[model samples]
Target chain A: MSEKIDRRMLLKATAAVLGAMPLAGCDLASQDPTVRGILDSAEELTEAAQRTLLSRQSLAREFPETAISKHFRANGSDNPDDGDYQRLARSGFADWRLDVGGLVDHPLRLSLTDLRAMPSRTQITRHDCVEGWSCIGKWTGVPLGGVLQQAGLKANARYIVFYCADTFGDSLDLPNKYYESIDLVDAFHPQTILAYDMNGKPLEVPYGAPLRVRVERQLGYKMAKYVMRIEAVESFGHIGGGRGSFWADRGYEWYAGI
Target chain B: MVRATHWIGVVCVTILLLSGLQIFNAHPALYLGMDSDFAHPAASIGVAQRGERKIGVTTVFGRSFDTTGLLGVSGRNDAAERAFPAWATLPGYQDLATGRRWHFFFAWLLVLDGLAYLVFSLASGHVWRDLIPPARQLRRIGASVLDHLRLRFPRGEEARSYNVLQRLSYLAVIFVIAPLLVLTGLTMSPALDAVFPFVAPLLGGRQTARTIHFICAFLLLGFALVHVAMVLLSGVWNNMRSMITGWYRIKPEGSLHVGEN
Candidate 1:
């Protein structure tokens, strides 16, 4: 029994040493550019694999009105601290205009009233955040597809980028004024709306007043808040970091379906 | 085939652990309810400012515990960050994009490897013959436990077949924990949620699935630790040879070599 105990201790020591070996490589693994390249390739592979499995027209789950949360928690940039945004908010956004231009037959600068008057959709869908929280809210807005149709998208347009009023950081922080983009497929989806109202009331400032994109099938960060402009583009090459969204610029996945 | 799959499993699982921890740190809190209170969390593992110092706090079921050094608070003084340390995660920096890239890449490998192993084991009757305890072994489980606690192992012919404890642990990990991890992982994806409307609801909610995923990962980690320990204690060379090669030179009861039998 004593000899058995000795063997057990010896084995334990050996195992401990072996276990620590890989852990020692943690820093090395992170620093290795080769690993980073592999990871990037992996992300592309994942995106391709998921896209293959996902139908372009499949709608995200819509819940009953009763299931809507009491408070649909506001995500990133809940309130725009910018002076211009504050000035517009002071007048209840009466002067707010949503600019739709770039790669379009006709550029549109539509006011809040024009958007309200257009063909709209109301959907109660769950918002899944990248930070792992979820909330349900009833969004009433004009279908983005109809709005884009009015603008007459150019044949070269491949991505629709939504620029927002809310800005993060300053000149020192680079051009990180919250922006998100979706492929033409998601943009043309029936459920993709530019929400102007929530829970039977006009959108609160914290909830991105004036307008917010509701790409329900994706995670919450893809839903860029605070309406400013919508630019249809052939590619996001010239956009902020050319990765599609502000969060993407800050190292979050451009495609946040998961 | 088992050796190849096992090594791949090791690499993938390691990446998954580091990346998964990083992803968890992005939120640092989990909830059982469908809709979480963004302001406050029911359970959280992150740092909080306590006067001049940043103290780590881990809260569960509304109770808070100071896990300052390891969790909640990490790094030196002012440089301290929240939840998991950088070394323990994939990207090292707080890049969710890169972390996720590593996670999904390894996650697919893990799933494929597990599936292959499962199919192979089932078809070859390895699950029944090796991983599952026979009725006779089941009856001696109490003795097996006693022997294990006393550091006594089977010898000669008995060593060739797994004891009841080994069978059960292998069975539990291969069947229960692995599938749960995969299913719960799928439950969190919005696209998958769209395809299978029942997934999120059936699992309670997406947040709930995330919580379960976290829990399942820890369970897998625990299983891995114990599994490694077992491999060491059971005779590293012999066990490793059995896995790496098809043959294991099992020593007889009182001898160092198999031929002595």
Candidate 2:
């Protein structure tokens, strides 16, 4: 029977399979939670494979004397809607003392001015946002590693979590926390500055002013803006749904190492 | 109708790739916020002292980094810089201009084709019946997906039509990646922006959208790679014919390695 199959039948079979590739492609990319969850899981494997294939990447190059884009737009929330933030904004972020606590012996609450007083590092590296944009800018700030050292992280700490002032509410059950997490690896990178300044100017409120993360290895979103408090933890489990950040908690891959 | 729908989808994908690569290759200025939405992480870095000078920045930030030539072999730099994007092809003289022309000229076709495809798909039962797997399959599909990654299991359900994985991936390209690509293109274009008042803010900004567009292409490209691989595995001749002629018959009698449901 197999050998006797008609040519038309064979052609129909071929047509069916060939014709369905795009449909197959569409099927793999649906949004039903089950389909989404299934796709999301498989998608991670591909991402991991690609990551392995392209591991040990040298940081992207920085050109000499390139003009920093005239404007570096904010990627996330501009002004946080939280009550404390609204009141703080009314006073112009003056009374605001960034609390650096949790898993540290000597927790620190330094004023924005006090942070500026510390020795600062300046670099002309370009900022890459996860959204398809790049801008070369001179970021000036105290190295974040320096600030962590001042706060004195305890021996057990492994991950650091940043709690933000903004919330993008979608899941009613889930807390609306705009947060991000990074391990000790990125926490210590040289260009991983806690950017207080951009383009030789103080970071405006929109671009994560007063303090935002610059995990230069990953995309710009890893650089959280409007930083309110930073906590050092042994594990990420209790940190806002455990995936790390707001997006991470949703369906986003945790590493975001890209 | 499905035949016409299929052609439109193919055309749309082709048009999208042409225009997308053009916009990418054009080196349009990508700003900071248009292309992405991640914005959390405030863990700080600290200091380490080797000598009186204290050479390296220490551990407050909770992210990895390295120093440049100033420190040389002693330090490392993170790979996030945009000196050259992963998607930018090194086009030759002959195809470069044509690629860009085809990209810009056919940009509308991709947009229109995609819109039409979406509308048609919604009207057809195919989207609900095949693409979006039923509630029961969702749990297993999710679990099977995890199992596939660990290599403990590399299978998912094998339906005559689209499976769970195929359906979801298509959804992502259509909704997440495609719209993002379109928005980013619009952001890079001044003429378009002039026509659309809220496009920039609707997408955060032109720069953000630009970055979003590029990353989304990579996702699409990834999907295409797996699509080809699946065709070869499932039987290339059969798959190709199905796409070209819009008819597919189940192979008479070969053992199918159905993916775990």
Candidate 3:
């Protein structure tokens, strides 16, 4: 009887340890540089596998107008609390300009009217969030490639970074402003656009009014909203937190195709 | 190859499951269509307030169930509002980024290990010889199930091969469920959807695929529990020895075996 009790105790102890192992190990492993590196390598493998399998011009699935979600949830920074953004918003963003520079032959500062005047593309596409939800919306905007072509992208330019007006944190500092970067492959993709219209209306403040990016092939977080500037750079090594985007700096995958 | 891959798969699946739960907690809801209809989730775990009290509510289809302390509301003082409790998740915290890292890394390893197993199993005729039951055995599936229920496992020469039920379950897990899990997982990737346009639609859409993925994960877990229980019931030491050393002692017919009780 004593032996049986001891065996039962042993079994319970083993089960308890086994149950707790993952919780403890995962936290410790994530902090270990080697383990973290090994884990982070999967992102690169996924990106490479996707790039190899997909053609450059392959388009994300576009939905019909009827398929568009009636209420699209605005995520992350829905409205810019920055003073400059508020000033621009008060004047209907007439004074807002998208400063395009960095590794470009021509530096252009284009106004909202200027962007609207450019050749535009309208696409009804699904926006997939990294949090596992998806929403379909109609976006009307100018293809990013057209603007890059107009700016005359330098031969060395490899990445296009977007600086947004919205600050993600409590601080109203410029350093906290939301930003995202994508490689030339995504930048020149036909569906990649700086959208100014959502669902047949001018983009609302809750949905990055005036301007937001629609990188259809990637997750919603990759699509920066409340666009303030566009930069063509060879590398984002010196950019905010050096991870290519606001979320990426906070440990989200830069290549959010998955 | 089978033993090595099996052990590796065990590790991968455990990490994947815990980390997957962590990721699931980020949303804590499931939908049926292509997109999430926020107002009408097919299933959701959320915390609802009743006056000064907080309650964990789980909605399935449209029916609400109070799954407090287990599902939506858990942790000390009921502070955590998550679908699955922290104990059930890797890192034991709300870090979606780290959870994703662990999930994808192990997911890749699992896929590679499965592929290796598949190639070796086919090359060695393991699939046909062990997993696929003969027509005669298939005909006696009901009898095999009865034998299993009675805890009467095969002995002597009969013990050299899997029974019909074992063969069928193994085949289903390997061919049907695992592959479905992989395909459904890939369907969630927007980039992959662009490459394989028909995958999402074929599966009834991305959100439906997500639901199916979650269901298939639980099914795999169920299979594991049954598999482990069977291993223990049949002969724990003998099974462990065979899996570890590839030497299973087959008792002679009608011979009394040690630890038979």
Which one is best on DockQ? 3
Retained native contacts per candidate, as fractions? Answer: 0.57, 0.03, 0.77
Residue-wise lDDT of candidate 2 within B121-164, one digit each (tens)?
78887678768877766767867577545544232235367756
Once model 1 is optimally superposed onto the true structure by TM-score, how far is the C-alpha of residue A198 displaced, in angstroms? Answer: 1.4
TM-score of chain B of 1: 0.92
Ranking by TM-score: 3, 1, 2
Tens-digit lDDT track of model 1 for B36-98:
766667689877888988888899988999888788777666366768876677656676666
- In model 3 chain A, where is the ten-residue run with the lowest total lDDT? A168-177
The stretch of ten residues in a row with the least summed lDDT in candidate 2 chain A is A23-32
Per-candidate clashes come to: 2, 82, 0
- Per-prediction DockQ comes to 0.41, 0.03, 0.54
Q: Give the candidates in order of DockQ, highest first.
A: 3, 1, 2
Candidate 1 per-residue C-alpha lDDT over A184-246 given as tens digits, one digit per residue, 9 for 90 to 100: 989999899999999999999988998999998788989888979999999997898778888
What is the Cα root-mean-square deviation between model 2 and the actual structure? 22.6
Error of 1 at B133 (Å): 2.4
Kindly indicate the candidate among 2 and 3 with the higher lDDT: 3
lDDT of 3: 0.90
